[model samples]
Target: MRRPSGRVMVGAAVVTVVLLVAAAGGAAWWRWDTQRQPRVDDVVTDMNTAVADAVAAAGEDAAVAVSPVVAAADCRLGPLRPGKIFTGKADLYTDPGGEDALITTIERNLPPRYAAGRGTAVAGVRPLQADIGTVTLSVRRLSPGWLAVTARSRCSLGAATEPAAPTGAAPGITAVTQLLAAAGTRPAGITEQRLRCTTGDIVTISAVSERTDTGDLTDRLAPALPSTARRFTTGDANRISYRDGPVSVIVASSDDGTAITAQHTTGC
Candidate 1:
């Protein structure tokens, strides 16, 4: 066999080195992607189990509780879209006999941040847990006697994605309409209402209570509003109230149906 020349040997060696480096780089990228893929199923399962366990331990009358740390984990590691999050509410029928004990158990076991979200005044807490891209848990009591537990999972998606548009009618008119419907009344007095869509494309509706106001309708209805509708406020005169509720919000994409929340108002 002919002996290989020095220049030819050097060139072959260079090519081989380049190939090895390329292969190594590809392998590293693949490993990173595999690791980064959110473990949605596992996280969700864990969240479900945690919630169930908390509820079971606390018993039927127990109020709900949530953990902020768990929520952060669910948001950072779960499978939901980045920046998107999950939230839930549970209604618990209060049994007079078990109410006190249940509330005690929830207050002792559930996390504090969650309790605050549910409005501590309400008695009986419900537990909530989630694992998507994020997790959040909270508990609260409702007026007219009901307990609520909520959980949220945040998405990892960044700010670039445009938020979804408002779904129902404009907030000022539609929110009032929804409140009336919930309160079992007819829409009246609302006119020339306009809504502004902000950062999250959030829609806010504000109006002054009309002369026909019969009760503290706005205050009564605020709590009942959907979770998407947040940061509620009343006007200076107490004659006007406003609700900054979502015109459109994202929930889990499931076969059952999309979950929607509406702002509830009584006066104005």
Candidate 2:
């Protein structure tokens, strides 16, 4: 048999090398794709496991401390549908008078990761727990009288650390001032008559004889007011209260029942 020419031999070697490289590349791509595509069943299983673990950790207690956060790498906003809310692990220490305190704490301490608008309120509440770091308690209000609450506990991956020491600093006054500015611009039946500010960021506003016509007041004030503010009936037939942020403005018809009287809180 005649030996193949050097050119032919070289060409053969090149073809073999190209085939080997292509095979290796294809294998790598296949491995990457398989690793990237999380198995649906596996994900479902993990979620179920997490939920079960959270419930088990909470035990029979209505409230338990759990981590509000889960694996950061896998963190997701899951199915938080409109008219619904979600709260991760929380510890329920005591039942407050109402959901207002809880809402305020959440707003001040753990603001939402995303806020579509400044005054937009969460439509509903949904709470959950994590088996592993921060305990969280959460609640959502559906309507004036309807609410849902949940609590859970979580664990941090690191070793136990000392609890953070509490600070005695007074609450910031700016919060109240900002709240007042927002309340003043409301379009309710009463308009701002006078406003006073004190050293501690306290604000007091008095509103006088505006109008008795509910239709006009609602038309103007309701549109401008934040969604968190609402009109609710009171014992007095011709009186109503507008609550926005931390301030509650009481509006009552004047003795003559033709004008409205509004009084805002001190240092709201």
How does each model score on lDDT?
0.38, 0.36
Leading candidate by TM-score: 1
Tell me, by lDDT, which candidate is best.
1
TM-scores of all predicted structures: 0.31, 0.23
lDDT of 1 by residue, 66-141 (tens): 2111223334433433333433333333434344455557556554433322233333434333222345554444
For every model shown, the clashing-pair count is 29, 26
Our model 1 lands, by Cα RMSD against the true structure, at: 14.4
Q: What is the C-alpha RMSD of each candidate to the true structure, in Å?
A: 14.4, 21.0
Residue-wise C-alpha lDDT for candidate 2, range 1-268, written one tens digit per residue: 9999999999999999999999999899767755554333233223323332322322222221222222322222223211112222222221323334444444343323312112235443222212222233334553442233343323122222222221232232232233323334322322221121122222224344434443234334444445776444332244344545444444444567555444553221
Poorest 10 consecutive residues of model 1 by lDDT? 193-202
